[model samples]
Structure formats: C-alpha cells, structure tokens
Target: MLQNTLEVSVVKNLDFIESGVHICVVANQVVPNLAPILDRNLKAKRVVLVHTADFLQKAKDLASAYSNYQVKTEFFKIQSAFDIVSLRKDMQRLFNFYAEQKPLINITGGTKIISLTMFEKAKEYELPVYYVNTDDSLSWLVPDVESVYHLEDRVKIKPFLTANGFEVVVNELPSSNKLLRQVLDDLIANIDGYKEAISQLNYYAYTASSSLKSVSLSENVEGLRKLVGLFAETGLMKIENNKLIFKDEDARFFANGGWLEEYLFHQIKQLGSKIPKIQDNLCAVEVCKKTNSVKNEIDNMLLCNNNLYLIECKTKRFSKDQSPEGGVSSAIYKLDTLMRELGGTFARGMIVSIFELSKADYARAKQYNIKIVSLSELKDIKRHLTSWLS
Candidate 1:
C-alpha cells in the first residue's frame, strides 16, 4: 500500500508553488519525467532532459510532448551511460548551468551510474531531488524530506504515445451500441454453440470480402442460421435468399473475426468503469514511430494505473498440432515487439483469442511475457480482467 492505492490527496503542510518550477529529469523512460509537468498545481515552467546519446531522439520526442503541454524543454546529453567519471563531469556542467535556476533532479530514469551521479551532484549543490515510482507517487528524497504525493491521472492517449516517440496518426473510438454489446454477451455465453458456425462464418466472410460483397450458402449449416440472425439483429449482417450479405467492407471485417476486436474494446471500457485508475482507451489506432518509420496498428489500447495495456484481439483459429509458421506464435511475436517498441517497460501486452492454442504456442507466449486469454477465460472475462488489472 505504499503508493499504488494512495490516490488520495496532496500533502497538507508542505505547500508547493504553482509556477517557476524547473525540473531536470534523468531521461530514460519518458512518463516519469513528464509527471511533474502534468500536475497543474506544480505548474512546471521548463524541463531539462538529461539523457545519453542513445536516447537523444526519445528525449526530443519528450520535448515535443512538453511543448504540447505548454512547458519548455532543454537538453543535457551525457557522453557515456556507464562511465562514472565522464557522467560526473557532464552532471557538474549541467548542475552549474541549472544551479542559478534552482532546478530539481528526478532520478526516476537513466542508467544507475547516471542516476547516481545526478543524485550526488544535487546533494552537493543542496538542490531538491525527486524520484517517480510506478505506483504514481512522487518522492522528495532530498534533505530527508520523506514526502510522497499521489499524481493525478491527467495523461491522455495521444500525448503519452508522443512522449514515448510514437504518434497516433489515425484513431477510431469504439461505439457502445447496445445491440452490438448484446451480441457479444450472447456469443460469450454460448461460446461452445457458436464455435464451429463462427469458424465457417469467418471463411465465408473472408471469401466474400476477397471476391464479392456477399456469399450464397446453398446448404443450411447447423447453428450458422442462428448466429447470422444474432449478427443481423445487431445490424451487422443479413441472410437474404440463402446468402449472407454484408453492408460494406466494415461489416465484412466484423463478420470475419473483427467481432472479437469490438468485443475486447468494449470489455476494457466496462473494466475501466469498475477500476477507477483506468484512464483512456482507444481501438483501431494506427501509430508510427518517429525515429524510424516503423508503423503498427493496435487493435485496442487502454491506459490503466498509469500503464498502457496493448491488447490484440484475435478470432483466428489455432490448430491443435503445431506448425513452424502458426497463427498464435506469429501473434505473440508481433505483440512482444510492439509492446516493447511503443510502451517500453511500462506497458503490458495481451492476446485475447477466441480459440485456444497448442501447448508449444502457449509456452512461446509465456517466453515472450505476453498474456494469453482464450475461449474458456473469455467466459468469465470480467473476473479475468479484474485479475489482470490487479
């Protein structure tokens, strides 16, 4: 209960100013450095990012985020990440320039040597020092202040991504249609009943999208009629004269395994309501990294407890027997890379599949530290999500 459950209030006696605060942050992970600026009560005027050469572009991206938040940013580059003597010289110069400004230092980021150098220099100069923890607490460690304050959840999806050197070029928010939600609930409740039918529907949907806007099923497949009727009730599809007619490409996409994406996005929103720390969520987001032109489309992304959760909803069927180029393994690899690239160490990646995978694929997901929630888990999704958030 140190800080995670301490989203209570600000410190009472030790009052902080609302302006003229200059914080020099050890820039490695970006969010910790941006915390103080996001707190309106602190009202940071400028932020001096102290980063190594490797993190130069990330630091610049963080500067852009500061500019977006109306806080100016400066840079202090270190020549070496681990060389203590070189880092001390650089820290000395940074401290000399920032001394007159009475700037503070945050040791929440950077390598251990860098943080140690910055901390020792701040103590020598008798300047204030701070550190941010994952639990959303700002600790004032200088002069044995022993004070910690809970940070407000003021971060948005766009700025958070921007600070991490990624840009949200295109985003589409989820629509909470009652009928669509009902269809999802029905599918989950009757998961076993619709498994085979949904698989056939996926095939037909994919074939239709590849060829025509519709498909004529000559044979009345078992349970397909009922499943199509559920989708038709949600206005997602219709059966006309032994044919499954999709409204458009979007409708076809939904029919062809896109429903799981829609389902998971809404499920996260529902989880957000019960979990107060859940902040922002977006589905169908296309983000690109600024340093390199690498692009990735996120099926669903949620901000909870100051951490981004990247979720990939897959309705693609997985085989019981293993193959070298299998669906689940590929999904695991993609989720692992995207999570590390976009969210760094502060993010969690999850793959929610409508079908379970083989033991080898499950082990592969575990190796990559990706969470897998499949059909059985989806039955008690809220409970599973609660455990996940915990």
Candidate 2:
C-alpha cells in the first residue's frame, strides 16, 4: 500500500514535469506516527523533512524508527521557523533543488511553517503536496481537493478542489469541523435569542463597567475622545496644553465661530427638524465668558425665539461608573443665574458631555429635560449637520 502511494505521488509530479514540482510532506512532532505514512506513499528518490528546533528530538526519534525505510529522508533545521526571512530562504533553497532533482516527497513538520512557506513554495512550483498531521481530530487540508487527503479519514472527501485560488472555499468550510465549534455556536445562538427578546421583555437594564481595567468610564466618553482625536486627525482641532482648540485653518469658523455653541445648536436644529417644531427661528448666544459674570465658562448657548437653550460643554475624562453630577449641577446653577440675569431668556438647558456619562447622570439630565448627547451620537449629528448646512 505504501509503495502504491509513493508510485502515485511520483507519477503526479512527473505529469507536471514542466512545472518541476517538489512534494512537501508536512508532519508535527506530536504526531510522529505520521512519518511512516509519508515513507510508504512518497516514491521520490529523495525526501526532505523541514523540522523546527522545537521538534528536532521528535524528528530524530522518528528518523531512528524509520532507519530501515528505502527512501532517503534528510532533516533540515528551520532556523527561526516563525520568522518570514528564514522561512523564505528555506523555501527558495527547497524549490531550487526540486527544480533540478524533482524530489518525490519533501515532508515539512509543523503547521506554522507548512501553512506559510512550504505551501507557498508548492504553489510556486506547481508541486503535488500532502500534509501529514498527527492530530486525528479534523482535516486541515484544502477542502474539495482530491490531491490533499487526511490520513485519519481518507474516505471523507473534501467538497472543494485544489487550485491556486482555493482559499475562498477553505474559508467557507463549516466551523463545526473545529473542536470548539459547538461551544461557540451555542453561546452565540443564546446571545442572539436573548437580544431579540430583550425589547419585549420588561427587564431592568443597568450599565456597569468591566472589572478588567481600572478607571472604568462609560463608552460615551471613550467614543467622544475618539471623535475629538479624529477631528484633530482631520486638522479641524489642535491639542494644546491637553485641551482641544479649533485650528484657524479655514474661514468657515467665522460663520460658526464658537466650537461648543456651533456644535450644540447644530445638533438641536437637526433633532428639532426631525421632530415637530415646537418653536420658531433658532438663536444662539455665548454667555459663560461674559465679563463680570461668576458663571463657569459656558461652552455655547442657544435661543430659539422665546425658547432659550443653555449648553455646558465638557471634555473632561470620566469612567463608566463615574458620574459628572457635581460638574453638571454647577453648570445648571450657572445657566439658571445667567437666565435670571437675562430676564428668563433661556427655557431649556443642555449638558454636552463629550465623554461617557454614568447611568445616574444620564437619568438626572433626562429629569431636567436636559439632553445628553454621547460622542458616537455626535458622529450622526455631524453627518446630518453637513447635509443641513450644504
């Protein structure tokens, strides 16, 4: 049986003589038992085993066991096996020799190198290759390729064929063929079902930070920071003294000058347009920086006719569990005082926390009719703002 396999391998290589093929027989140290399979079926005049230093002892043991085999099997140490440089050099040498001698079987050990270099060289030389895996669990060979067969289940044929562009088929193979497939499938299915039933089921949803890291902040804060960074990346803002400042890059800022006021009013306008217009023509004012006023530096202020809006912009960093209750309360007090000074001009107040907001803070803002806009939500706001302005 071994002789017949060897004859077939040799015949296949000869058929592609113009390609000057090199047969790669790959095995792992854990599966030293696969050595004989390569010895029996590969009828090449010369065979080479690409073994890593980690598997040298196992290769020697296998070599000693098969000392009586008629085929000459030589071992080549794969220096820095994982390194691309070493693997490429080894593959070049192997392919160059195969071009000259047309070796029947060039067995490579381990999947790491086999999947990378050896397989690459086989494709380059159009060589007939076979993988000898020690693990009897699942087939790693390319699916549907008759030339590639697993030693454990030779009868179970792959659904795909062996070709240069065969990765598409192999990638599509059912993950059930993997050992952990069942566990993963069950977990995902349960999660999906739970998510689907969540809306219908009256369940109390609470937000908590993962214990994996300290200084846990809400996803909102993290997302806003990322957006700020993206704006900086696009040269819209510059970081100075750990604060984001609008860059004087374009004259568009002259029309929408104050960053915070412009950003908030734009969002309110966008949201109001989507919802029913409870108010008329939008008006915005910057009151925090008013001279002689004891109010905290207000980011932006908006007034839609008689409906006045006060906005407090904060780029402060806070974790998921941390609430900006104190900061927000201070802003509300300042805005109230400012509104009183302006003869009750402002009707609505808004706290634009560019960072994550704790569940408590979010609920608190909702109670006061103050909208809480997260950084991720701001992206959608900006997209609409562009369309509205355009």
Best by lDDT: 1
What lDDT tens digits, residue by residue, belong to model 1 across residues 1-390?
Answer: 112122234445335332355555545466787766787766688888877777888888888888888888888787898988898899889877877676766788877777788888777766666788888788877634446778877778888889888899888656578888888898988886788888888877887876445567857576888898887766778877777788777788888877887888888787876898888888888999886777789998887767888888877686544454556767777888888877778778888877765677667887777778887778988787777777
> What lDDT score is found at residue 209 in candidate 1?
73
Candidate 2 lDDT by residue in tens digits, 260-349: 344454445555565432232222322222224333333443333223345565434333443334455545555565444331322455
- Candidate 2 is scored at a TM of 0.29
TM-score of each: 0.88, 0.29
RMSD of each: 5.4, 27.1
Q: Pick the candidate with the highest TM-score.
A: 1
After superposition, candidate 2 runs with Cα above 4 Å error: 1-41, 104-108, 111-114, 133-144, 147-390
Clashing pairs in 1: none
